[model samples]
Target: MNTYRLQQLLYEETDIEKIQKKKHNFIIDLPKYSFNYQNGLLTLNDTSFFKKNEYLFINKHNRYAACPKHCYQFIELNYMFSGKCTEKINGEKIDLKKGDILFLNAGSKHAISSLGKNDILITFLIKEKNIKVDLLSQTKGFLNISMENITPFFTDIFRDKQYHVFRNNEPLSFEQTLNNIIYEYYFPQIYSAEIIKCNLLKFFLLTARRSEKSCPDSQLEPHNSILLSQITEEINKNFKSLTLAVIAQKLNYNKNYISNFIKNQTGKTFTELINIRRVAEANKLIKHTNYSIAQISELVGFSSKTYFYSEYKKHFDHLPSHDRQYSAAEFLKV
Candidate 1:
């Protein structure tokens, strides 16, 4: 079916939604998990809802149906395809408009207000295992920490099970990617699964890039903001040989001052950021190219294979070979 047909399909209310309208309550069978939401129990949607071997589930949120407070067993991404919807996540109310996107991690307690018939919200449930930290490692505000230390960062953001809403400043590419995924999902063909995966990766990469670049210079001190812009551009372009000393000389700042400024802003030492950049680039090559591990290490500016392996493992918690094996499996999977 085409996308227009899919839209027509989504506009039609389901039997469950019809029943819900009569009862004025969402009556879906949900796990009885005890959660304190305004001193009430919150339902849990466990992994049992997913079939075995399924990594992703996509559907349109019911129109004119108010979903009850519930938490999920998997991560979720929601796109406000049209119109608007209001949702309360962990006590915070969020209003999402057309082209906006919302990301909710597993265990985020949320309740959706009733949606209008014109509202079209697309929901995607992704198994937690499907997320690759390497992709998000480049996100701003995520300090360049080793894999061992990254857990603490995750804990900070996810401890509250917070949800993030990103307004679609530029919607063409974002909406096109979402449309492509929905098309492949509703109209499956040979290699559709792989296409969905590729589109999902692109979706995440675009999100990361948007988040990284969305930070306005007005948010930072004027001098520091300009310095940060220059420093990041330098590192992104020349991470191979870029050092705090080299950056300091290029920017005409004291080496110690540059080091301290980087640490203060990102909570990561200058060396850690460079290594993280190198490892992130190497991971991209490992996943997308036929370069050998040794060649990738050298290409990313790691002088010694041993040191490269050490840094890569620290960031990914696995040898580069693991990524190669995983890529091979994905390629050969039916």
Candidate 2:
């Protein structure tokens, strides 16, 4: 699709927006807000616009609409197609420019400021079950920095009830990938589901690359950056057999010093980091392999089955066996 067609598709007003506009009183020019709330917050339980069997829904933000404090049961990704917008995610105010992407994990509390007529924000709502898990592996090396700066949307370990913002530095390639997703989802045809998945994967990779490019090394001290990078490489490669002592011996640093540094830098202890990696790997195995829960837990370096189960449930909110079956069922249904 050409740029004009894409713009036309996104800019076309929706029925709800039209009704919202008609309800506006120009005399006072007050901001439009949704009072659909429970317990002082607007928590959406389902995709109001999604059709049956539709897991992905896309739409433009209503112009001049100011959403009140709210959260959703599914992932929400917003792209600043034009103009600018501001939002408060978990009490942090963020200013988003054109070509920016904001990923709000499920259950993250946030509120958006009113958008002007020129601001064009496109949002994609994806059910939690439909979000791909393999994206965690992509955040291993240089892209790991992306996680620290902009965070990730697809991992159970890092989905800490937070919203991540990424600037699309390479707009040409990144926007094209996003546009492909919009086109496929908006005008679905034969195999559109598969096509949209491919586009979404590409879009995520582009977001990772953009995050890497946009994140400046100056954010972290020079030595801290190098050490963090090395530490992450070791953890990613050796988490299956890794320990604080083992990592310290390999890096030729005092175990206590390395442990303290890791905790201070990442806000996670050495053991916590290892457990995060192990549980993430176990999740991947549960989705892709036939290994039993015990075997998968053992393979990821957990010694006690009970401990592994606890950690897995803590991160994923599901038992390993149940998650495997549920994942399979979700795959077949999709």
Q: Top lDDT: which candidate number?
A: 1
The residue pairs found clashing in candidate 2 are none
Clash list (residue pairs), candidate 1: none
Off by over 4 Å in 1: 29-39, 131-161, 171-173, 215-334
Model 1 is weakest, by summed lDDT over 10 consecutive residues, at 147-156
How well is each residue in 138-177 modelled by candidate 2, as lDDT tens digits? 3455344433233334663234446677765553356677
lDDT tens digits, residues 1-334, model 1?
3778767777788887777767777665434452324334354454444676566788888766688777676777889988999998745589999889888877666788888778889998877553445334334365453322322212333432366667876743588788788989888899987777667666765765565454344357888888988988999999988878899999999999999988877667998889989999999999999999999999999999999999987666468999999998998995
Q: What is the TM-score of each candidate against the true structure?
A: 0.55, 0.54
Clash number for model 1? 0
Supply the TM-score for candidate 2: 0.54
lDDT of 2 at 180: 81
